[model samples]
Target: MHIITRCEEMKIWSLRKNKTPMLHYFLFAYWFILLVWQNLGAGGSANRGGMDVVIKCGLLVMLMIYYFMHATGIRRDILLMCMLLVGVYAIVKIEGGLDLSKILYYFFPFLFVLLIFGVGWKFELNKRQLVHLCNMLIVVVSYIAVYALIFCTDQFANAFSIDNAYGNELKSFLMSSHEYGMYLVFGIMAIILCMEFDPEGTKNRRFWYFLALILFSVNLILTFSRTSILSLAVLLIFYVLIFAKKRLRNWFLILAGIAVLMVLVIPSLRNFFWEIVMKENNDAGRDALIDFGMAFYRDGSVSQKLFGWDYAPIKAYLASSRGLGSFHNAYVQQIVANGLLGVFIMIMYSVVTLYDIFRTIKTKKEGSHLSKFFISFAASAVVFMTFNTAALFASAIDSYFMTLFTVVVPKYVNQSIRAGTFDVPIKNRETRPNVRRVYR
Candidate 1:
């Protein structure tokens, strides 16, 4: 009886301290599970009526409820309008528009809103909180990844079966199709983690970060994903060169040492790396897809060319003509699906967020941990996007990260604006100090 009373007391204390319902945690978990499972090709349409649909629907509903709870504003309203337009466009083209699996895309605005305002618009995670959350996530995922590697290798090698205990496919280079997505997510996470630990200032942190780099690098290699391998390397190099707080020469030396060690220690990796870079057929069918997309852009009917082919048409085109699900190139996917206009908007949105993140990095009062981490995150994200379609508009992970940063960064800018500490953007059409104006 005493233990039960103490448990109840603790629960109430946690609730009051966060001032958020327990439901927020549940929704977050559900969303994360969905995110992880997206790589596995789980439910994405209503026709299947699977558990994925149920989970996605639950997430959408919960987020919408959260949005209303926080009181709607014009900014959110305008964003939602744009999202709805895009969602409608995405749906009319796809086969199962309002189905269970595809519902997640339809409600992306809800996800963005929930992240920003679900709990009284308190989405601004300060430097400490961001580092804490990202690092904790990395530690948890990295442990699972390591365990998966050993367990899958042993279990699959002996039994000659596909399934492993850790829920990855044993025989393939990647434990699962989701490996690409995981690489993208965790690759960014690793950069932020290293930035948090100080890329150059301290010896102890450098030691731990190098360990993390090795682990994440190995994880990327084992997955055998060329896109991930390239992106992860780009992220690490950028973190060292652009975001590190230490000496540039030393940073280059450390990166060089790691590269040399990797080549020497992992014989198979050297072969794989060379094959991806030096081999002829490195594009993995991207060339053909681009041809088809460009051809369609040139020859398709007026309406088809304007909106491009809808989802159904594109899927149909792929199946009847080429036999595939997507164009596999994000930029082409945008052009094929929604025409040049949609592609333009998508690019602009990405550019806007990237601009904001870098702008904030420039404003970092020297010696602030937050500035360094933000710069690292931004750099990793930018470099990763160049090589991976996972950052494309169709991917929920890209949308989630971009929207979260968009809303949060502006808050910091608002603080700067109020303090009259305009750091960058010296252009002055109006003689009033060239700081960002606070949204009314």
Candidate 2:
């Protein structure tokens, strides 16, 4: 009787310990669902006036609660700097007499950035928990893939159909094909990281990851996004080069060579590649846009040049000139809207983040799982940001992935330092190798 009572007590204790994380997992699922639904036009089409506001407000509350529950001391400086920038921008916009509602709309995305970092700071995951998170992501992507496959069969079948210009692209109920591509790429990258880091797992884990890779890869290709495809390809190459064992790297090189040879030798493959990747002169107008933005900045008055243009002014200018609002390139957009000071701030943020990653790598054990995953994620993010604007100042899903790595990397390093897992010495090291590592 005593033994049975002890076992029962232990079971209850285990359940109590797990309850919070389980709740977190469910909350994350809900958050992800909202992200997808918002991108899917469900919230936009159904509740254009009020539902969207309710959803955003509700999500903001949930994020705040979640952050408080799991918040840690990591990345407080970055958070503060971000908040400072937002405040400055708000002041500038308000001073320029921009619409109050528009100002709030512009500020909303930064809040998501804060929420993401908070989640990352407090994210403590055991191997099982990490696996569970990956599984949740995989399931979401798979559902999107299947939905697109089933409902858009005719679109998929006729790649060049004139019926719909985007018939070949797999939007997957998303607002745009590019958005769908980004989500697929992010999902695929996460699965790849999980598979690489946690290879020796439960039965058939590798198989499942491999299957998911193929599925997401196909879906990504179907999106027909040149930038996303390039980003994914670059990330994959970096992953193998940086993380793979010597023998594995050799095999990867050989496979890459074979793929290139096949593309060159096969006529149909060459034509397909040319049509999909090489035929599009996507950069044709981008240079002109950059030039125009620079001229506009140059011609502005002293105050206008210093602060650049407010959102309303920029929107009006674009409407009158090109009938399109975006500056296309994030760097150019910042220059046009926020001037040199804004550009400087952004550069500082990127430099600090990159420096943090560099410092962590120096202290981390060679081939450490955390280091490899962080590097892979950072590579993807850097590439994505270079060619895309979603992660720059938008509260899109792509931005969340970038924010996740920034927070998670610091948290991992902090934990490792506390545990003395880092290879570098904590104390005087002049007598040792002249190497220093710090997370400032």
Candidate 3:
């Protein structure tokens, strides 16, 4: 009886109500499973009436409901507006409109960030804790990645049998190496924020974070993803060269030395590095796809240019003519999907976010390290989404993850600043003025 009572108490303690529900961790778990399943081409689709669709949507609805319970009028209004805006935009005037899978995969997580972070609801944890929590997620995922590379192999990350690049490609849990690249994007972004927010974190914590960053960087290299690498490079340049603290900058230099040594010592690694730099992945096939897209766009009528034939017809036409569905270029995908309107909306995704981020950064110059991370991210994202990397309208999970950072994350961070609810205590807080208004 005593043992049973103890067990029951433990369970209750774990489930004790917090604004950040532990169940959402399970939601992340499901997302990981989805990545792995999709990697293996075994994942279900909405058309097949897959349980993945039901469970994903159901979990999101539940998360929203839980937040609504504690929400003030403002929170509810924001949540409702998020739902309606995403719903109406994603559905209205599109081919095969109202794809639960698309909305779930592409845009659903955008709103969830608001609930956990601040705009829609506040987790019991402070902003510093929340940011670290996110970084720790990368560390956990990196551990799994190590295990998968060793024990699972081709099941997690695939062996590259491509024409030019010859090595193991890291695409664990997602369909493409490029998508996995964005996973690293999220990891690196979190690390940047954590380091800036808490540069003197415990030695043990710093070690673990450094380890996670190494793993993420190594896999990013192995992925041989050009745009992803370029995006990260820009961020590193901005941070390490321009804004990094002395201690952090030294560590970066040390890593650079190590990378140089590896290139000199390891022939295969050297060749692989050389190949990525030389743009070995470029080919005529990609060019053809771009050509087809431009030609199709050029031939469109005025009405089609304004409203588009939606993405379905483009996919169908591409399949019928070229035997490939995607244009392999994000900008081209926008041109064909919803024509000029699609192109404009897609551009606005980055443009508006960049404007917001810089506007925030401009106001935060006085002893504020918080803006450094956002500046790094905004610059990197613009570069990443510009290539075959995944534009906002590309229907790739990369795009969705990017949106979470570039759009939703910024909004909430701004909200937290204005409300004075974000509790990230900096070592230099005493030197800076109180948080000022983030521009509209």
> What's the TM-score of each model vs. the native?
0.66, 0.77, 0.70
Q: Can you write out model 1's per-residue Cα lDDT over 1-440, one digit (the tens) per residue?
A: 12212222111112122122232243335435655565345533333346655665665566556544533222444455556765655655565445544445434543444344333332223333333445555554565556656756664243323222223322233224334444434545545554654445335566655666666555555454544455555655666666655786486778789977897689765554554332333665768888887887878777666666645556777878765666656667667756776677666655655565556555555333344444544554454444444433332544444333333444443333333333322232122321233333
Clashing pairs in 1: 44-101, 44-102, 45-101, 46-99, 46-100, 93-311, 93-312
Please list the Cα RMSD from the true structure of every candidate, rounded to 1 decimal place: 11.4, 9.7, 10.3
Distance (Å) between predicted and true CA of 419, model 3?
3.5
- Cα RMSD for predicted model 3: 10.3
Give candidate 3 misplaced runs (Cα > 4 Å).
1-52, 66-126, 152-163, 166-168, 199-201, 246-270, 276-284, 317-323, 365-367, 393-396, 424-440
lDDT of 1: 0.48
Ranking of all candidate structures by their lDDT, best first: 2, 3, 1
Task: Find the candidate with the highest lDDT and give its number.
Answer: 2
What overall lDDT goes with each candidate model? 0.48, 0.60, 0.59
Superposed Cα deviation of residue 3, candidate 3 (Å): 61
* Global lDDT of model 2: 0.60
Better of 1 and 3 by lDDT: 3
